[model samples]
Target: MTGNGGGAGPARLGWLDALRGVAALVVVFDHSSATLLADFRRELMPEFNTSRFGIMVFFLVSGYIVPASLERRGCVRTFWIGRVFRVYPLWAVVVATVLGLGLCGVVEIRDFGGQSAVTVAVAHVTMLQELLGTPSLLLVLWTLSYEMAFYLLVVALFTVRLHRRSATIAVTLAVLAAASVAAGAALPASALSDRVGTGPLILVGASVMVVAICCASATSPVLRLFGGVLGALPALVLVPFNGTVPLWEGLVILAVMFLGTAVHRAEHGQGTWWRAAGTAVVVVGCAVGSAYRYGDGELFTRRGWIAAFLAAVLTFGAGLAWRRRQLPLPLTGLGTISYSVYLVHPVLLAVIDGTVGRARRDDPALEAAFFAVLLPLCVLTHRWVEVPGQAWGRRLASGPRRKPVGGPERPLLPFRRPCERTRRWYP
Candidate 1:
């Protein structure tokens, strides 16, 4: 997250860090449990769905901060640059490490379902592989696809001057999510990819994303508008039609994120709290209704999904409520390295799975040991990889920056380089 002003003071942001830290640990447990705490997971997941809880929290946090980051910058080019540097460096390092591990025979790489290397590489490079019908190389990367989609949508709104309508957008997505289920509009995963060949879809999607980003970053107003609209095309086409997740779920994900944005807007006085509260109500109700009507998925129960969703929303609300209080350093520190924890843990678990194999039974000691090892390693990754990349991004973004036409009010969007002032707040 960038910028320290716009009503997001240290107290407000610290709670977000605490939330990230909590979510990271939950997600780490959700993934690692299959190998280290199999029985416990089996017992817990059917009722709680720890994975869903963790990610929903993440999406909410992303919603809360991402739009703020863009609006605070007031420059789409610099915003994109900041996002690329913040996300890609750690991602590239982790992907390369995973591939290296696979090549070394330390872990088995997941099958790409017969996709070509070129196609896979292109898909992953765009960070929309999950929505493009290509499997994510790492299990955790699917969420990044949605994050990228939100970024595009945010840019689109900023360019078109609809950036402040987050509450309306959020409610619309939620209602659509509910309505889709009511209409019984069931679509297979990757339906678009199935109809249009994977290669063709990837080619078109990747090409459009490149053009969209480049044009959105351009100085010409017409080009920016065109690029903004074009950028949203891929996300609009892919999320509902091609994502690996169910249609309702994908829509819900986006809605949840926008709901977070609404919360941020309310906090900053850009919008009213009543509007934010109402959006949250609509979104949560629609999400819960959609899950209920859709019934259970292959891997999760309806009850479990609903429980996790509610828990995530409640967790975020709790953090928001306590936004002013000073949070514990250990929790905030974990939040600082939460991204590293999220990416790095999957690789470590994969190695353990391929090498020694999973624990035959519930092993609390082994689970404890895994965390003991993971935290320190994530800290190192954060220090070496994340910090330097963000520093470079700031340096680059500082050059040749100008505010977008009709962007947020300057007083409401003050500039404060986050990397220099506060600890990193990974979405």
Candidate 2:
């Protein structure tokens, strides 16, 4: 049943990947509306499917999976290495590429390209360009910073606990969230964020709430259902006039995730019907607001059904077969380099649209054609430069490894806590 390397792991959760992949594309699609479906997407669908929110879905998946990996891998180092590999190297390449282009004068030198060696080194190496207000060479790196912070938090917590304190340690973070609001701190909202989305304390609180909820979820179904409700409720907050929400809303996002993860854990029997429900919630809930804002206000009066259809299919449209471990190569490829793909695609849009789009202004057909070509090229970049860089990062962080039980000896993909074992962590 297993291959030489245990056939690249077991029935790989194609659904998670496929779902994540869809989430990414939906965000893209929603953004594309900025061009093609301009009015509809920016207004009606903005809340329905967003890149930031899609990323949160992956975080939910990660929150669920990381614990399992930790259980099998047996140490924090492996987890750290895996996370580093997954993030930095590819990022460095983008930073370098932007710099390389700046040197060549092929691209315009935005403020991010400064004249000093220290400036370049610190910005690129520390991944602090976003904080410096450099208009990130890669627009998506902001989220990477938050993700890195999340990783460091995980490592720090693990180190302090030494697997000794209860998982309950995550509880104290909630008070921090409340305090962030009180202190008026700037914490990045999601893993991919700018302006520190919320505040560190608030972020910590969200993480803690997430951890607490997940710990409870493993053994409780009711909490899971409650999570579903929490996740669904956020659709309401995405209003037509929500010009600015309090920083505290980020905590709400995390709170929804807490509920979402819980619900996902306790739920099963995935297929068409369930997918439809989720899609409806996201599409109707989010897209309606988007279309109402950006669209010509003809959504219900004109393209109402089309907006609804796209939202449903895009949001909750699940293909259970995609969840199988033996994922299709495209999906697998995307999953493998998703981080890179996410980072590169935004820049790719700016570049491709700048080049191809300038020539085809007032021609939506041309923009679509260029987008089609760009998507594959985008994926290839992920496969080559970014993927390899991430691999290098992991190798640096990694100490070496042991095999996952019943699996061939292979590099662990970081932590995913398991349910069966309580004290098997150090072994």
Candidate 3:
């Protein structure tokens, strides 16, 4: 979730920023604990599942803001342009750094399990490598696959005039998720890869994604609609079959995201509070039910999953309650650089794991030291990398808007009655 800040608009939502900051730290802890606090992590993971908790909060924030961004811009081309610039520059830099490290033997990269470099590169370029059965260079990038899927779905709903039905969409996805669990598994892991072959699926999915984004951003309405649907079809096909996660949980992820959108709609007077509340209940219930039915996986406990899911919902609700109030600058500042924090910490952790190795026992001091180094680096990256990239996006999007006589030039995305409550918060 990001906006063109060069467009004069409403005050930023500090609460969302605070939430992102909190989630980023939690995610950092979730990963760092493995190396620095292994014993404590073992004790806590089966009960809390910190990773799920952190990611769900992020998905909620993304749900709350992303559609509003598209609606604000009212031009698919500019929206796509904003998204590419917001995400890719830092991502490219990070990937290059990882490759460089791998080359120089500073850190080892993940084995792609027989995937050709060309196929892996194509899948990663689409950012759907996780779904297409290509291993992520950075393990955290699996979540981005889903985030990209969500973006396509959001654009599809928007183009079809169904964006306002967030509550209904949330409930429907939840119900489908519950049903998937009840019906038993439809496919094994990487089902699409098994059927179509991983390399071919990667090529096809990547091609579709590129075409969809380009066509959706086109000026023609028919192309836009076709592109939106084209983008959505891979997600619809992959989540229930080829996903790395269980079918039900993958669906639940989408449901939770729509649930966040419903909350945003309620906040902005586009929908009633009751609708949002009801959607939350249904989505949460279905998610819990699915977890119970699916039982525990090899790596995660059902109890942990259920607890984390519930806690994430409660945490989001708490944030929404305080949305109108000012948040502390430290928290908001952390949120402002949360994206860098999320992406960079893993690279740092990889370097640490490779060089220093894990502690023989739980070491809180080492974890603290990791953060002390990581946060300042994130601040620097956010300032130099993200800010400049986004500014370039704004300039690209705002190409030559007309000025009125003796007045300021209009924004590229003309202002509709803005929804102050729906300010974009990047993941």
- Write down the lDDT of every candidate, Cα atoms only: 0.87, 0.42, 0.83
The residue-by-residue lDDT of candidate 2 on 1-427, one tens digit each, is: 0000001253455555555565566556545546555555546642344554565555544543443344344544455455545556566666677677667655554553333554535444444333333345555565443333334333433433332111222222223334444555543322322333323323333444344334323324344334323322212221101112223333323332332323333343222434434423442333333334333444544354334334433432344334444657666445554555465656555564444443322446754774576568767777786657556754554434444566443443333232222212322
Query: By summed lDDT, which 10 consecutive residues of candidate 1 come out lowest?
Result: 418-427
- For model 1, residues 1-427, the per-residue Cα lDDT tens digits are 2112123565667888899999999999999999989998988977998999999999999999988887766677777888888888999999999999999999999999999999999999999999999999999999999999999999898878888899999999999999999999989999999998999999999999999999988766688789999999998989999989899999999999999999999998989999999999999999999999898333355888899999999999999998888899899778878889989999999899889999999999999999999999989989999889888988887765344446542333233222211111111
TM-score of each: 0.92, 0.56, 0.92
Model 3 residue 75 lDDT score: 64
Error at 99, model 1, angstroms = 0.5
- In terms of lDDT, which candidate is strongest? 1
RMSD of 2: 11.1
The TM-score measured for candidate 2 stands at: 0.56
Pairs clashing within candidate 3: none
